[model samples]
Target chain A: MISKASQSFQVASPSVADQARLRLAPVIRIALLLAASVIMLAPIAFAVATSLRLPAESFSLPPRWLPLPPDWSNYKMVFQQVPLKSYIGNSAFVTLSIVIGQLITSALSGYAFGRLQFPGRNVLFWLVLATLMIPLQATIIPVFVLISKLHLADTLASLILPALSTAFGTFLMRQYFMQIPNEFEDAALLDGANQWQIFFNIYLPLAKTGLAVLAILTFNAYWNEFLRPLIFLKSIDKFTLPLGLVNLQGYMGTGSISVVLAGVVISLLPVLAVYLVGQRYLIEGIMMGGLKG
Target chain B: MSVQAREHPASARRPRLFAKLTEPSLAGMARRKAAMGYLFILPTVLGIVIFTAGPVLASFGLSFFEWNVIDSPKWVGLQNYDHFVHDSRALNSFVTTGKFVLLAVTLQIFLSLLLAIGVQATRSKILRYFFRAAFFLPLLTSAASIAIVLAYMFHQDFGVINYYLGKIGIAHIPWLNSSGWALITIVLTYVWQQIGFTFIIFLGGLAGIPADVQDAADLDGATGWRRMWDITIPMLSPTLLFAAVIGVIGALQVFAEPFVMTNGGPGDATRTVVMVMYESAFSFLQIGYGSAIAVVLFVAILVVTAIQFRLSRSWVFYQ
Candidate 1:
C-alpha cells in the first residue's frame, strides 16, 4: 500500500546492498514524518505549555520551552479572573442548538430532494446551490439589519437563526439518501406506509451515518464560528468561547499570558475532545464532501 | 455525476408500482405526497427565502443609501461606487488580499499535496492515523484562539519563533510589527489552521485511486516520478480542482486571522476586503460604502466561480 518514491527511483539493481537500503528507507521517512508533526503541533503544544507556566516563567527572555512545576493555579484563574465557564456554556448551547436545527432541516430537505417526487425538485435544489455561489459576507450586512430590526441583536438568537441556514447540510444528506437503495422505501410503502411514514420510519432510521456526519460537521463549524457571534452578542455574559478568549487576551493586560493561555486551553477542551473522539467519522464526512466536489 | 446515480435501477421500478396502483385515488395519493414533500422542505425554503435570498436583495437596495445603525438611510445613489473607484484604501486592500490569497492558498495546496502523498505512502497504520489526527488538530481549534497564540508566538522580543531563530544563529524577524512581514505572518497562521483540511481532502482523493493502478504502473516500469506525473496526477485532477477552488475561495475571504493578528495595522498593509467591509460597516458606520464593497466582492467571487466552472470542464478528470 505504501512506497517511498525517491528511494524506489532506481529499482533496476537487485544487489544485497540495494535491498538493505530499501529496508532502511522507511526509517528515514518515519523520521521526516516526526519532524513534520513537530512543526504541525508546535503552536498548540506551545499554547498548552504557556498555559501551564507560573507568571514568573512567562517573561523569561528565551521563554521557557517547558513549564517546570506546571502551575495548576493558571487553570483556576481561567474561571476566577474571567467568565470562561459561562462563555463555554453559551458556546455549547449555540453549537448544540445549531446542530439540532441543521440536522432537522437538512434531513427533511435532503429526503425531499433525494427521494420524493415533487415538481421543480431539480430547480429548487439548484436554487439552494445558488446560495453557495454568493459569499456569506455579502448577505451578512442585511441579515444584521434584519436581526436588529426584529430586536434580536445582542442575543444568541441572532447567531442561531442565521446559523440554521445551510445549503451544504442539505446537499450532504441528499447525497447520502440518494446512495441508499430505494427498495427500503418501496417495501415500506408496499406495507401500507404513507410517504411521510416511509420517510420517518424507513429513511430516517437508515440515515444514522448521514445524521452523524452532519451533526459533527455542524457542531465543529458553529463552535468555532467567530465573526457572527462577535457582531451579534454584546454583553459580557452572552459572549461565546471564541469571543470570550479574545476578550480575555485583551483583558489580561499582557501580564497574565499564562492565564490567557489557560483560557485558550479551556476553550479548546470540548471541541478538541469531540474532534479527537469522532475524528474517524468527521474525516470520512469531509472526504465524502470533497470527492463529490 | 449524481444525475446518473439518481436514475439507477430503482427508477425503472418506480413506474411498475405506479401502474399497479391505478385506483381512482392514484392522483390524490400523488398529490398528497407532493404536499408532504412541500411540508418537509418548508423550513429550508423559508430560511433560504428569509435569510439568504432576502438579505441579498435587501443588501443591494441598502447599497444605495447611507445609514447608521440608529438613523434612517439617506439616499446616496451611485456615489458609493464612484467613491470605490477613487478609494485607494479599498484598492490597496484588494492588493493585500490578493497577495495573501496567492501566498496562503498556493502554499496550502503545495504543502497539503505533499503531506497527503507522504501520509498515504506510509505503511504503518499507527503512523497514518497519527499524522491525520495531528495535522487536523489545529482545524478544530477556533480561529481566534489560534490567532492569539500565534500572535504571541510571533512576538518581536520574547516570541518562541525569535527564540528558535537566535538558537539557530539567525537574526530576529519582525513577524507582526512590520507591514511586510505582518501579512506573511497572517498567511502562515492561516496555513497552519487550514492545511489539514486540504490534506484530508487530498488523502481521500489519493485513496480513491484504485490499488491495481499502482501495480500496473510498477509493471510498466513507471514507479516513481514518472508514475506520479503521468498517471497519478491526471487521476487526481478532480481532487486537485476541488482543493484549488475551495482553497482560493477560503483564502479570498480570510478575516479572523488578520483581524486578530495585525488588525490590518502598520498603515493598512494587511487589510483584507472582508476585514475592510467588516470595519467599515461596524466601525466606520459606512453602511452604504460597506455594501458597495460587499457588492464588488460578490461580483469578484461570482466571476471567479464562473471561471472555475468553465475551466473545470476541461481540467477535472472524472472516473
Candidate 2:
C-alpha cells in the first residue's frame, strides 16, 4: 500500500506547486530514458542507414542519415562479393548443434544434481559452480591443439565440439529443476517409472521454460562467437558469419564502407529474427542468469 | 542439500536392521540409482576435464617451452616469462586494458543503472518493452559487426561522427588512428554494445526488490535520492557486484573489438593481452610465448576476480 504521506500528496486538495512537481517527475524521467535509448539505438540505425546509402554518398559531407532511393544494390553486392549463404549456414549448423548438445548434457546433469541422490553430490555441484568463472580464453590454446590433435581443426566440429556443454547451462537447468515439486518425482516412482523414464517423460516436459531459455541463450552466444571460429577455422568457405564478415571487411578495406555495412546488416538478421521470436525467453534468461547466481 | 534432507524421513520409516538385511534389493536399487546419477553427469564432467582443466595444465606446460607448430618444442624454462617482464608492448597492453576497464566498466555500470532507474519510472508497458529492446539488441551482435559499423562511423575524414563534430564547429578527432583517441573509441564501442546487457541486469535487480521495501521507505519519508542511495543502492548491490564482476572478467579478455576495428593499430594503442597472444601464436607462430601470455592472462583474471569478490563484501548485500 502507498504511504499515508504519498496518498496525501495525491489527494484532490493538493496545491498547484505539488501538482506541478508531480506532473514534471515522470515526464523528466521518461525524457531522460528516451534520450538514452536514442543514443543506444543510434549505432544500429546508422548501420542500416549506411547499408541503404549510395556507395558514393557514404563518403559525402554531413553524412546522410536517410538514403534517397534506398540503394538495395549494396546488399546484392555483398552477396556477390562474399558468400553470405555459406556463412549463415555454417553459423546455423554450429549454433544449432551446440544448443542441442548443451541441452542434453545440461538436462541430464541438472536432473542428477537437482533430484537424484548420489554420494559426492555437494562436491560435484561445487565443481559445476566453479566452472562458471572459467573463461574460455584461459583454455583456448590447448583446446585448439586438442582439436588439431583430433584432426577436427578447420571443420565445423572444431567450432561446435568444445562448446557442446557449458557449466552455465547446466547450472541454470539445475536451479530450475530444483524448483520442481518433489510430489511429481514421488508419483513417478510410485508408477514404477525408472530414472531415465521419469526424467524423459515427467521432468523434461515440465522443464519447457528452462529448456526454451537455455536454447535461446545458447543461440545468442554461439551465433556471435568470433574468437573460437577465428582460431579454429582456416578456410574461407568454412567461415562462420562473424569470421566471414571480418574476412569480407579486409577484402573490402579499400572499397566503400557501405558494402561492409550491408554485410553487417545481413549478419545481424538472424539474431534480430531470433530476438523478435523469443524476446521473452532471452530477456528472462538474462535476468534469470544474474539474480539466480 | 534439500534433496538429501528428504531421504531421512524415508529411511526413518523403515526398520533399520530389516531394511538392511531383508531388503538387499533396496541396496541394489540405491547402487543402481547412484550409477544412473553418474551416467547423467558423465558428459559434462568429461567436457570440463578435456576442454577446461586439461587446457589449463597444457598452457602451464607450454609456457616453459619454445615451440612453433612447425617444429618440435624445446624447453626454454622461464625465458618467455623473462621476456614478458621486459616486453614494453605487453606492458603497454596491460596499461591500455587497465585504462579501458577503469573507464568503460565505470561508465557502463553507472549509465545502465541510471538508465534502468529512468526506465523504471515509467508505467507504460509498451514504452518499457520498446526501450528494453533498444538497449538489449546490441548484446545479440558480434563484436566484429559492431566494430565494422562503428569504425566507419568514426572514420576520420568521411566518418559521420567527425562530420557531425565539424557541423558543431569542433575539430575532427582522429578516433582510431591516434594513440590517445583509439582506446577511447574502442571503449565507446564496448560500452555501446555491452551497456544494454548490463541495463537489463540492473532492471532485473531493481525489479527483484520487494515492493514492500519501497513502500516502507516511502512511509518513512525517504523520497528521491535519499531513498535511492539509502534504500535502492543497498538492495541493488548484489546485482551491481554481478555486473561489475562480469564486466571486469569480460574486459580482461578484450580482443575482437580492437582486432576488428584498429587491428591493435597505428602504434599498438589499443592492443590487449589477448591480441598479444593472438599475434604471437597465430601470426608469429610462437606457441610457447603465446601460451605464456595466455597463462599470465589467466592468472591476471583469477587475481582480479578474487580481488573484486573480496571487495564486494563491503558493498554487496543479500536478503
Candidate 3:
C-alpha cells in the first residue's frame, strides 16, 4: 500500500537515452541505500570489533576489521575494573520502576481524557501538552533542589521519581484511547457496568498495543538515560549503565581502549534485546506520535 | 409525593436500567462518575504539579536569587540576568549552542530525507525493510556508548578513521583535539545516532502520500525531482515540519554527545547550553546562575518552536 516517492529526479522525456537511465535509477538507489546502511552500522560493528582486541592492537594502524580469536579478556577486565553488575542492576531497577509508573499514570489519565467527560478535561489536556515543551534541562535545577531537600540526592529514586510521569506517554495513550469506537463503551454502559468496570474490562484489554508501545519506549529511554543519573546519582554503586560507561572512558588512563569499548558494547545489550523484540511497537510509536504532532 | 412519581420528570430520559434508582441515588451516581474521572487523572496531575510545574516556577524564582546549596538563597533581583552582559563564556556557550543546533539539525534533516526517499524508491520490500532497520539500529544504543566508541574511532593519533586516511596518503586530522573539527565530530556523532528518528518519520510521511498523486504526476510527465519538489514535498510538508520542529527542539538540548565525546573541551568548543547549566549548578555550585541559563533556554525553545509553526503556515500543506 506504500507508494514510492519517484526518486529518479531526472525529468522524464520521450527519448531512448532517458528511458535507459530511468531503468537504471532503482539500481542506483539500491546501491545508495546499501551504502547508507553500511555507514549507519559501521560504528557499532567497529565498537564490537574493537571490544575484542588487545590494548596494543586497539590503535594499530590500518585498523583490523575483525578481531580474530575474539579476545574475551577485555570483557572480563571491564567487570573487574568497575561495578558493572551493580550498574546494570541499578539501570534495570530504575527503568522498570519508571515504566510501571508511566504506564499506570498514562493509562488512567488517557482513559479519563479520551473516554470520560469531566468539567476541566480540555484544560487539563492542554496543560499536559504544555509540559511536553519544557525539557528536563530547563527544569532540572529546581528538580535537583527539590530532590535534595527530600534527601533523595545521590539516590536512584531521584531519577525514578521525577521521570515516573511523562507528558508524551499520556498524550500517546490519549490518542490510542480516542481511536476506539464509542459503541463498546455504550454497550458496556447499557449493561450497568460502572466506569471502573468499563475501563478495566472494555478499554484496557483493547489498549494492549498502546500500553506495549508506552512500556517499550519508556524502557528504552530510562535504561539508556545519562543526564538524570549523572546529575542525581553520586555513589559509584548507584551508577547506571550510561554513567558507568562515561566513567570507564574517563578513567581511560588505567583503562584500555579495548576494555572501554567492551563496556560500551556490554551496556548496549539490554536495550538491543528489547529493541529486537519490540521493534514493531517502537516503529509504530514513532509513526503515530510523529503523524499526530 | 411518591418517590417514583416525583423522580419521573428527572428520570424520563434515563434508560430502564437506571429506573430503579431514586433521584438522590442518580445524583450520587453522577457525582461518583465525576469523582472517578478525577481519580483516574489524579496521579498524573499530582506528578505534573510536583515534578514539572512546581520545578519550572521554582527555577524561575531561583534565577532571581543567589544560592549555592550550602547557604540560604539571597535575593539579588536583576543581578543574575545582568551577568550575561559581561559574561563572555556564557555568551560563547550560547553562540556555540546556536552553531551546534544549526549544523546538527540541517545535516540531520537533509541526510534523513535523502535516505528516506531512497528507501521508499526501492522495489524490493525485503530490502526496504532491511535498510530502514539498519538505519534505525544506532538509536537502540545509548548516546554515551555511541560517543565513547566514536571518541576512540575519531582519535587523531590512534583513531581508526585517521588510520584509514593515512592508508590513502592523507595526514591524520584532529577530530576531537581541535575546536573546529570537535564541533563537527560531535555533530556527526549526534546525527549518526539521531538520523534514524527523522528517517522513520519521513518514511511514515512518504507512506501516507497517496499512490494516485504519484500516478497523476506521472500522467503529467512530472518524474523524479520534478514530482518530488512539486507534488510530493507539498504533500509531505506537514510531516517535514513535524520532524524539523522536533529535531530542532532536541538539538537545542543536546548533552550526552558533548559530555562524553569531549567534555565540552578542547577549550569549550562543543559546550552546549545544557552543559553550561550542568557545570554551573553541579560542578561550580552556582545554582542561581544555572537557573537563569535554564530559564533562557526554555524561552528560546518556546520562541523557536513558535517560529517554526508560524513559518510552516507558509509552506506546510495538508491533504
Q: Each prediction's TM-score against the native?
A: 0.92, 0.91, 0.93
Q: For candidate 2, write residues A84-118 as lDDT tens digits.
A: 88998999999999999999999999888888889
lDDT of 3 by residue, B76-126 (tens): 997888996578888888899999989989998888888888887677889
Candidates, ranked, DockQ: 3, 1, 2
Q: In model 3, what lDDT does residue B200 have?
A: 92
**lDDT tens string, model 2, B23-82?**
324555576678788999999988888898788889899999998887889999999999
lDDT of 2 at A55: 83
**How good is chain A of candidate 2, measured by TM-score?**
0.89
True contacts kept of 3: 0.71
Name model 2 segments beyond 4 Å from true.
A1-19, A290-293, B1-25
Model 2: lDDT equals 0.83
After superposition, candidate 3 runs with Cα above 4 Å error: A1-8, A253-255, A290-293, B1-29
Which residues of candidate 1, in runs, are more than 4 Å off? A1-21, A61-68, A290-293, B1-25, B312-315
Q: Estimate, for each residue in A133-242, the C-alpha lDDT of model 3 and write its tens digit.
A: 78888788999999999999999899988887778888888888998999997798678776678889999889989999999888887888888899898899999998
Consecutive 10-residue window with the lowest summed lDDT within model 3 chain A:
A1-10
Q: What is the lDDT of residue B169 in candidate 1?
A: 96
**Which candidate achieves the best DockQ against the true structure?**
3
